[model samples]
Target: MSTQFLKLVQATRVPPLMGPKKRAASTAEHASPLGAYLLDARAISPGNLAKALALQLREDARLGDILIANGWVTERDLMMALSAQYGIGFADTALPPHDLDMIRSVPWELCLQYTVVPWSQTGGMLILATSNPDKIPQIRAALPPGLGNVLFTLAPEVEVLKAIALGHGKALARRAEAKVPERMSCRNWATSLSSLVVPTLCIVLIFNLLFHTTMTLAVLSLLACALLISNVIFKGTALWFHLTEDKSEFHSHRDHGSQTKRPIISLFVPLFKEPRIAGPLVQRMARLDYPRELLDICLIVEEHDIETRMALARAAIPSWFRVIVVPDGTPRTKPRAMNYALNFARGSIVGVYDAEDAPEARQLHAVANRFAIAPKKVVCLQGRLDYYNPRQNWVSRCFTIEYATWFRLFLPAIKRMGLAVPLGGTTLFFRRDVLRELGGWDAHNVTEDADLGIRLARLGYETEMVDITTHEEANAATWPWVKQRSRWNKGYFMTWVVHNRQPIQLLRDLGLRKWLGFHMMFLGMILNAALAPLLWSTVVVAFGMHHPIMTLLPEWAVWPMALVFTLATVLTITLALVACRASHLRFLRLWVPLTLPYFQLTTLSTYKALFETVRKPFYWDKTEHGAFGGAEHDVQTPEAAGIERKPVIFGTPIKDTAPNIQALPDQLTKVPVIKVGTDGTIRRIS
Candidate 1:
C-alpha cells in the first residue's frame, strides 16, 4: 500500500513544489505532444469507452486503444482521425520519431488494443485504451508493445464503487452489508456495572416515587425508556455514516470565497514530560510536505521544565520553528499552554499535535487542498488519529480498535450530520483568527479542542473533514492507558459544565438542531464511556451470580424485559466491535479475546478520573513513555540517567499521577511557560 493511491484519487491542485502561485500537474491535467498521431473525439464515444478505460490505472494510456478494447469506438474512425491530425495513415502501435518517451509512458494495453484494433489479445500489454482519439494517436506515436492494455474511456460521471467492483468482481459487490449485533464490551465488567449509563431501572424507580401511581409510573418510565432507546438508535446511525469515505467540502455563498491564497498553517505540539517521544515528534513534523517557510511549527514547553526546554533548544529544527514556553503556574492542563501559544501564532490556519504523534506527510496539504475546494463555510478540518504501536500489547490493541471506530467511523458521521464535531485531541486544523475570535483555547478546560469546536460552531463558523488520518503512540499498558483515559473522560464532563453554564446563550447560539446535536455528543461521550462498561460487567454478573434478573420481575413482565435487556446489551457490544473493527477472527485470536477484560479498565479509570477531577482540579499526570526503548531510552530523569536513557528530559509533572506527579508543588500547579510582551513585560506565574 503505497499512499500514492490515495494521493492520486484525492489530489487537489497544489502550489508548485517551490512557491505559492505555480500549480502542479494534477491527476486531471491533460497532455499533448508533437510528432504523434492525434486521436480525435469523433472516433469514439466517451460513455462506450469509459468501461474499458477504467481498467488502465496508468495515467498515461492511449485513448484509442482503450475505446477499441471497450468495443464502443472503431479502429477505422481512430485511424481516420489520427491520419487527419498527423498527416499519416493509422499504423501499428509504433514509436513515431520524437515520441519514444510518450509511447513508453503510455500504457501498453492502450497501444496494443488501439494501434492494432484487435478484439482480444493475451493479458500482456496492460493498458486501457480510451475513447479519446487524441490520446490514441499519441499512444501510437509514443508507446511500445509488451505493455498490456485494457480499453476504457471517460464517462459523464464515474461511480467509484463501480470501478472498485470491476477490480474486485461480482462476488464482492454482492457481499452482504455488515449485520453484527452489538454486545457487552469487557468480559468481567465491574466498573461498567457501577458507573456509566445511569441505569434504566433508576429511571423506572424515579417514575414510581415521583408520580406515585403504579400504572402511570410504569407508562411514564416506558416513555422515558423509549426516549433513551431513540437516543441509542440515533447514536448508532451517527456512527454508521462516518465509516464511509467522502471528500465533498462544506461551502457557502460569500464575496471573498475564491481559492487563491494558500493559508499559512501553524502547527502546535504540546510537550509534557515524555521526552522519549521527541524524536518521533520531530520526525513527523519534519516529514510534513508543507513548505517550511509557510509553516509555524511550535514545540510548546513549560517554563519551569528545564529538561524539556533544553531538549527543544538542542533539537535541530527550521528557524521558522519555535519553542514557546508557558508560565509554570496557571492552568496545568495542555489547553492552557495552547492558549498561551495562540496569542503569538501568525498563521491563517492552526493545528495541534501531541508530542508522540507522527501524522501522515500529506495531512497539511490535504487540509489545505480540501479547504481550497470546499464550500468556504467550514472553519476547521479534523484529521483522523490512530495508534502507531497498536500491537504493543493486548491493551494497546483494544485502545487502537476503540480509537479506530471513534476517529474513523464516529467522528466523520457526526461531521456529515452538520453537527458540532468534537475536536479530537490531535490532528485538528482550524482557521487561526477564527480561534482567537472565539477566545483561543479555554485555559480552564482540559479538553479544549472539543469545547472550542462547540463554541466555534455556536459563534457561526462550521466544522468539516479533510478525511486525512495520522498515528499516535498508544499507551503501552492497561493502568497507564486508564489513567490517561480517566483524565480525558473527566475533561469531557467539565466541557459540558462550562457550556451549559449559560443555557440560554447556548440555545440562542446553536439553535435547536445544533443544540440537540451538541447535547447528544457531550452527554453521549460521558454516558457511553460510563454505561458500556457497566452493562458489560452486569451481564457477566447476571450470568455468573445467577442474580435472578427475571425472578425479581413480575411474572408477566420478567421474560419480556429480560429478553429486551439481554438482546439490547448483546446488540450494543456486537455493534461496538463491528463499527470499530476490533480485528478479524484471526487477529482476535491473537489480540482481542485475551485483552477483553482489561479493556474494561476504561470504565474503571473513568470513575477514578471522576473523583480525581473533584479532588484535584488541573491534575497533569505525567505519562511515562519509554517502554519501547527500554533502558536505551533518551529523556531519562536523574535517577534514570545511570541507565540507558540519557538525552531525554525528566520534567517535574504538575499533577503527577505517574512516578512523580505528586511531587509538583502547589505553586507550580498551573502552566509552566511564559512569553515576553512587546514592552518586554514578562509574567512569572509558573
Candidate 2:
C-alpha cells in the first residue's frame, strides 16, 4: 500500500504534526478492527491507544477524535484505517472542481452542520465527502431529496470545511451580514435616519414655538440636569439592591459532579490585524481545564487578513483547534465573522472571546455545570471581566475601577431587577439552539452583544451572571482608549436607535418597568456623557466663577441642582469603592475619586461616537492588543517562526497567499469508489 495516510500531515501549519514513518502494510488489513489495524501499521503505539480509549469512554467522544486531538494519529490515518476497517474508501487526493449544481442540491448550512460536502459525481451517483463518517446516517437522513444514489468518502474535516466555504463563501457572507430581521437591523438607513432626525427636529420645533432661544437653552440645560439626576437615582436603586441581595448567589460555585459527562463547548476567538497575540492566545487557551477532546476553540480570521494568518501559521496551534477563515465581505465586523463561523461550531454551547482574553481555568466547567442545572430559559451566562494590568498606569487603574463597578455591582443589580442586561463583548456563553433560533446577531450593529441581550429578553430568555472572570488587557493609552470607548458608545447609540424605532412595539415586548429601565440605561448613558459640558458648567458656581445656567436659575432650582450633583458624586464614589472591595481590589478604592477626571474622557469619546454613528455606523474600531504583554507569558516571537514582522497599516488591502486551492482532475486519481444505499449499506464499486 502507498503512504497515503501521511498526506494528512501539513508541515508548515501551526501545531505541527508528526506523521508515522512508512513501513510494510499490516497483515490484518482485511480485518475491521481500528486499534489492531493502527497498531499493525505502526500508526500508533499500544499505550497511546489504551489512553485514548480511556478518554473516549470518559469524554463520550470518538476514539479517532481522542487520538487525533492528542496527536497520536493524524486524521487522515484514522480515516484510512477506518476505510480498511469498514470496507469503505478514502478521498485522499485534492478536492474536485466546484460542481455548482451538485453544491446547490444540498444546503451548505446542512453540510456545515453535519461536516459533509457533495464532492463530485461518479457512475451517475453523487459522492458526499465527510470528515465524520460516523455521522453519515444522520447526514443521509437530513439531506434534501433529488440526488439519486449517494456514496460517502472520508476526508479531513478542515479540508471539507474549506471546500464548502470556497463554494459558498459569498452566499454565507451575505446571509451572515443580514441574518437578523430587517426590522431589527440598523442596516436599514431610512429607518435609522428617521429615528434620529425626527426626534431632534421635534424637540427643536417645540422649543422654537414655546420659548425664546436663551430660555430654550436653559430648559435644555435643566433637562440635562434632570436626566443626570434620574440616572443617579436609577443607579442608586440598583446599588441598594446589590447591597441588600444575598452574597451567596454572587460567590456560589457550581458543583460539577465527578462522573457527569460535560458537553462540548466551542469558543470563537475573533482576530483582525492581531498578528503578535496569536502565540500568547494559544498559550492562554491551553490553560483551559476543559477536556481536550471536548474543547472546540476556533480562531476566527478574515480570509484576507494575511498578517494574522501568517501569525497563526507560525504559532503552535493544537490539533483540536480550528482556524475558520471568514470570507472577506462588507462591514467586516466581529459579530459578522462570528455569525459566519457559527455554522461550523460543533458544540451545543457557543461562546465568544476577544484575542487578548485569559479566562479562568475552570470557566468552561462552571458554564457547563450551570447550564446543566439551570432552567432552559436561562440560555446565556455572562462572566465578569477585569484587567490583567490594572496598575499599569493611572489610566489603567481608573479603567479597572470602572469595570469593577459595572461588572461586579451594577450589572448584577440590573439582572436582579429583571431588566434587559446589555452584554459586555467578551466572556459570554449562550445556548447554541437559542442563539441560532434568534438568527445569531445583527451584523450591522457595532454592539451586537448588547443587542443580542435585548433580543433575548424580548423573546423571554434570561442571561445569568457566572461568577468566574476573564482578565483582558486594559486600554491604558489615551488615543487607543478614546477610539475603543467611542466604538462602544457608538454601539450603544445604534442599539438604542434600533430597539426604539418602534417604541410602542418595544414597550409591548418589554413591560413598563423594563422599558423605563432600558431608556434610563441607554439614553441616560449617552446624554450624560454628551451633555457633560453643560452639567460641568455648574461647578463654576462653587468656585464663584461666572456660570451661564447657574446664575440664571431660580433659587429653588439651584439648591436641588447642587444637592443632586453632590449626591451623584458621593453615590458614584461609594459604589466604586464597594465594588473594588468586593472584587478584592481594595487598593483601587483611592482611584475611585480620581475617576472624576477619567469620566471627562467620555465626553470626547461621546462626540466621536456621535460623529461615527452618523458617518459609519458599522465600522469596527479594532483595538490593537499585546500592549502590556498579556498574561505574563514568555511567548515566541514571529521571527522565531520564520516570519518577518512588519508594521500593520490600517485598512490596507491584504494580499492572499491562498494556500491549498489546487483543483483535482475530473477523474479520481488512485482513490477508490463505492456505492451506498439509502440504508447506509456500503458496497465496493472499484
Candidate 3:
C-alpha cells in the first residue's frame, strides 16, 4: 500500500515483448490491465517472479512441502537476480519476443509470485495479472516441479484462485485472512486511581473546600487540564508512528477486476531557496505507486529561485513530475508556495512534503493501503518525521526525543481525543479533490500544517496515520538549532493567529473537550515553553537539597507559597513524565532532573520567535550542522543513543547563494575575491 511509492526501481533492463499466443481460456493480444500497466504480456520478468516465489516458499513450512520443494523451478529466479546483481552472465537479451508466445492480463507482481519467469530460453512469456499480488507467491512457491516458470497469472480472482488450487496444494482454498480491528484498547492505564489519581483528586477537593475558590484552585485546574490534553496529543503521534511501521491496508485489497483500486493522488514538494534538495527529491518521483501518467508530482519553487528550476531540469523528469515556479511577490513562505502548487496539481488525492525529505521507501504504499481500508472517511495521512542523524549533539538528541514523542504519541492521541493534528513539514499525503474542496493550504497562516489539519476537521474528513516515516537531517550546530527553532515557534504563533480568525466556527465544530485539547497541545506548547523559567524558578529552590531551606516570609506567608509552588511542580513533573514515557525514553529518566533546569532554556527560543514575528513572520531559520561536533557523527546503523549526524548537507549557507550548488553550472573553483587591477579574471582575494 505505498499510498504513494514504496520503491522506484529504475528498470533499465526490460526486453522486447514476445509475440502473442492464444490462451485456451482468453485472448492474449487485448485485455484491459486491471491494476497497473505492468500487467501487459511484455512486462513480467520470469526471473523476478521465480525469485519472489522462492522467497515465499522458504518461509511457509506448510507450503514448503509442495512441488517447489521437489525442484520445481529450483530457485531459478533467486539465482537470476544474484547473477544479474553480480554481473554474472547478464546477457543482452539474445532471445526475441516474436519467437515466443506472449501471455497477457497478468501482472508483473503475479509473475514473480508463481515463478513465471518473464525472459526465458523457452518460447513464451507468462504474465500474472491478479489485483492481489500477495497471493501470487503463495501459490507459486508450492507448484509441482513440471510447471516450472510456465504459468501465467490472471486478473480475475476466481480464475486465479482456481489456477492456484490446481497448481498449488488445496491449503490456500481453506484460508481466509482476518481483517484488522479498527481500534485497539489503551495499553497503559493512566486513568487508574490507585497509583496517584485518587490521592491527587482528594487533595484537590479538600483544598477547594478549605480555600473556597482562589488563584491556587485556578492553577490546579490548569495542571489537571494539561495532563489530560497532552495525553491525547502524545497518543495520537505514537499511533501514527506504529501504523507506519506495520503493514498497510492499501496493499490488502484483492482485485478480481473490482473498480476500486485506482484513486488519483497529487504530490507536492515546496522549496523556497533550496536548490540543493530539489533534484534528489524530484528524482524520487519514479518510485510512486500510482500510475506514472495519472500522478502529478509538483515541484513548487520560488519565482526568483532560478537555481532550483535549473536543478530540476537537470534531471529532465517526465511530464508527470512537473515544476511550478511560483511568481515572486510579498509573503514568501512555505504555505505561499504550497498555495501556488495546489493551483496546478491534478489528481484525486493530494500530498505535500518538504524538499529535504526522503521518506520510507514504502511511505506512499502505506498511505494507499491505509486509504483503501478506511476509505469512507480517511482522506489524509500525516507521516512522522525524525532526523536520521538526530544525535549530532545534546540539542539534536533532545529534538529527536521531542519529535518522537510529538509525532508518535502526542498527535495521534490528540486525533483520538477528537482534536486536529498539526502535521510535520514533510510526507503529508492527501486526496487531491478533497484538498481543493477545502481550498488548499492557507495563504495567510504561517504553520500551514496545523491550520490545514484544523481545516480538515472542520470539513468532517478524518485523517489516519499511514505506516510511514521520513528521514531528515537535524540542524548541525547550536546557532543553527536556535535559529531553526525560532522559525518554528514563530509559525506556531502565526497559526494561533489565523485559526482564531474564525473562532465561532471552531468552537461549534470542535466542541468543548476537543477544543480544550487543541488549545493545550498547540497553545499550551507556546505558553509553557515560553514561560517555564518564571513558573519553575520558585520550585527549584525547594527541590534543591544543597540550598539552605530558609523561611524568609513570616509564618502566615510561607504556607501558601509552599502549597502553590508544590502544585506547579506537580504540574511540571506530571507533563514531563508523560512526554518522556510517550517517547519510550526510559533511559532519560535519570536526565529528567537534569533536563528540568534546561526546560526553561527553551524559553529563549520562544522570546526570539516572538520578537521576530513582526519583522520576519515567515523567516526560514536555518539550522546549521556540525556544532557540538568533533569527529564525524555518521554511523552505518542507527543508534539508540549517541551523537548522530548525516555527514552530507546540501545548499549554501542560508545567507549566501552565490557560491553554493546554485552555482553548479559555473566553472569557478574558488571566489576571485577582489578585482584589484580591473583585469577580468585573475585576482584572488587572499
Candidate 4:
C-alpha cells in the first residue's frame, strides 16, 4: 500500500487482521472474519483497527464503510479479504432479478435503515447483500416469520445507499408528505372571528345604542378612566415589588467550571431586506464570548431575499455561522422563518436576536448559567432591550424612553410580582425542548414573541428576566415607527383573541390573577393606545373651548370626570419620571411632560393596527433597521455622550450627584474639588 494510503488508514482506523486459524468445523465460525485475517496479513495496522473500533462504538457505521470513506482501503481490497476469510463467493450485481415475494420479505424501512437488500433466494436460503455484512445475524433476526437460512454478501456502501434510495422512494416521499402540511397550515380563523369581528361589532352596537354623543363620551371617559387606573394599580404594584424585592436573588451565580459540559446554544437571527447591516451583525455575533464550537448561530434568510444572501456571502462570516434559507411560505413573517429554522437547530438551548441587535458580549454565558441554575419549569429568559440611538431624533428619544420604562421598570416589576413577562421580540432565550413542545412560534401571529410569552404562562412554564442588554436601532422616522408599533398592537390583539377562544379554559389554566394580568397587559395596553387620543381630545376640547364637551355631560359627572383625568395625568407623569430614573435615562425627564403628545402618536398606529387586525391579521410590518446610519451610529452609550453615571439604589438610580456631595466646611471649601471614583470617593487637591 502507498504511504498516503497507510497514513489515511491510520487516521481512519481501518481494522487489522489476526493470524489465519485452522478451518472451523462450524459454519458460524466461518462468518466473515476478514478484519482479523487482514491484520495478520499486514494489510492494515493494529493501531488503525483499534481506532476504527473506537469510532464504531460511537457511530452506527460499519468498519469497512468507515475505511472506504476515509480513503484508507479500496472496495476491491475488502472484497478480496472477505472472499478469503469467509470462503464464500461474491454476489454479482448483474444476477437475475429476485422474485417479488423474496424482495417484499424485508420491509423497505428495514432496507433503508440497515443498508441491506435481498438480492436472490435459493432453496430455503435468502441471499442478502449489505455494506455491513457482519450485521447479517442481526438482520436475520429482524426478518419476518417463515424466512429461513440467511446468506450475506458484501457490497460497496455507495451502491447499497443508491439501491436503498431507489427501493424506498415512495416510503421517503410519504414520510416527507406527512411533514409539509404542518408547516403549510398557518391560519387560525376561530381566533380571528372571536378576537376581531365580535369585539368590533360589540363596540359598534354599544355606540349605536347610546345614539347621543354625550352618553357615548361619558361611557368612553369611564372606560378610559378604568383602564388608566387599572394600569396605574398594576404598575404601582410592580414598582413596589421591584423596590422591595431582593433583585440579587434573580441573578444566577453558578460558575461554568467545565468547558466540555457547556450546553450548545442555538442562536437564530432572522434577516430580511436590510442587507447593509449583515456584515456588522455577523461581526457582532463573532464578538460573543461564548465558545465558538458550542455556538450554533444560524442566520435565517428568506429564499427571495437575494440581496441579503449576497451581502452575507460578501461578509467574512465565520465557518460556524450558518445561513439557512427559509423556503417560501405563507405569512412570510419573522416567526414563520424562525419556526422553519427551529428544525435545523442543533442545540439544547435556543436564542433569538434581530439583524440590528448588538447583545452584550457575555449574554450567552449569562443565559447558559441561568438555565443551568433555573428550575425545570423556568423554560425561557428574556434579556433587557434598549435603544442605543436614543439621541438620534425626537421619535427615537421617545421610543427609547418608552422601552426603557417598560424594560427597566415595568418588566422587572412584572417578574418580581410573579406575573407573566410579555417577551420582547429579540434577545429571548428558550429551552429547546420547551420551545418545540409549545410548537415553536406561531407563524400567523405577527407579534409571536408576546403570544409565546402568554402561551408559556398558560402551559405553567415561567420566563425569567436575564440581566443582559441587547441594543437595537430605535425607529427614528414617523411611518416606520407607526408600522412597527402597529404590528405589535395587532399581534397582541391576535394573542388575546386566540388565548381567549375558550375563556374558561384559559382562566383555568392561567388562574384568576394571571388571567387578569394577561388582560391588563395585552388588552389594557391596546385600550390605552386606542383611547389615548379620544381622552386627550376630551381634555383638550374641554379646556380650550371652555368646556364645550364638558357642557354636554350631566352636571354631576363633570367634576368627577375632570378629577379622574387630572389624577390619571399626574400618575402617568410620575410613572414616566420614575421609569426614566430607574432606566438611567434621566435625560428623558425633560420629555416626560410631553408624554400625552408622545402617546398621541400611538393612536395612529393603534387605528392602523385595528384595521390590519380585521383585514390582514398576520401581516408583518417589517421594521427596517440601518435607516439612521449604521451600527456605529446606533450603539452610543450614555457615558460616552458625557452623561454622568449614577449608582442604583432600591431599583432606582439616583438622579443627581450634586445632592450626595456636601459642601466642605467653610474654611476647607475655598478651593474647587473634583470627583473621580464611581463610589464618589473624592480626592481634593489645591
Best TM-score among the predictions, by candidate number? 2
Instruction: State the displacement of the C-alpha of residue 40, model 2, in Å, after optimal TM-score superposition.
Output: 8.5
Q: Identify the candidate with maximal lDDT.
A: 2
Model 3 TM:
0.52
A best-first ranking of the candidates according to their TM-score comes to 2, 4, 1, 3
Candidate 4 lDDT, 513-579, residue by residue in tens: 8888899988898889887755666665455454334555665665676777787778767777777
Clashing pairs in 4: 16-39, 17-36, 17-38, 17-39, 17-40, 18-36
- TM-score for all predictions? 0.55, 0.82, 0.52, 0.68
> Candidate 3 on 383-488: residue-level lDDT in tens?
7776656545565566656666566556655566567777776778777667666656655345667767766776677876554677666665556667777777
* Runs in model 2 lying further than 4 Å from the true structure: 1-60, 71-77, 93-104, 141-145, 190-192, 195-211, 256-260, 540-554, 582-584, 631-686
Candidate 2 steric clashes = 1
Query: How accurate locally is residue 353 in candidate 2, as Cα lDDT from 0 to 100?
Result: 91
The better candidate by lDDT, 3 or 4, is 4
Residue 257 displacement in candidate 2 (angstroms): 3.1
lDDT scores in order = 0.52, 0.76, 0.47, 0.67
> Least lDDT summed over 10 consecutive residues: which range in candidate 3?
178-187
- Residue 640 CA displacement from its true place in model 3, Å: 26
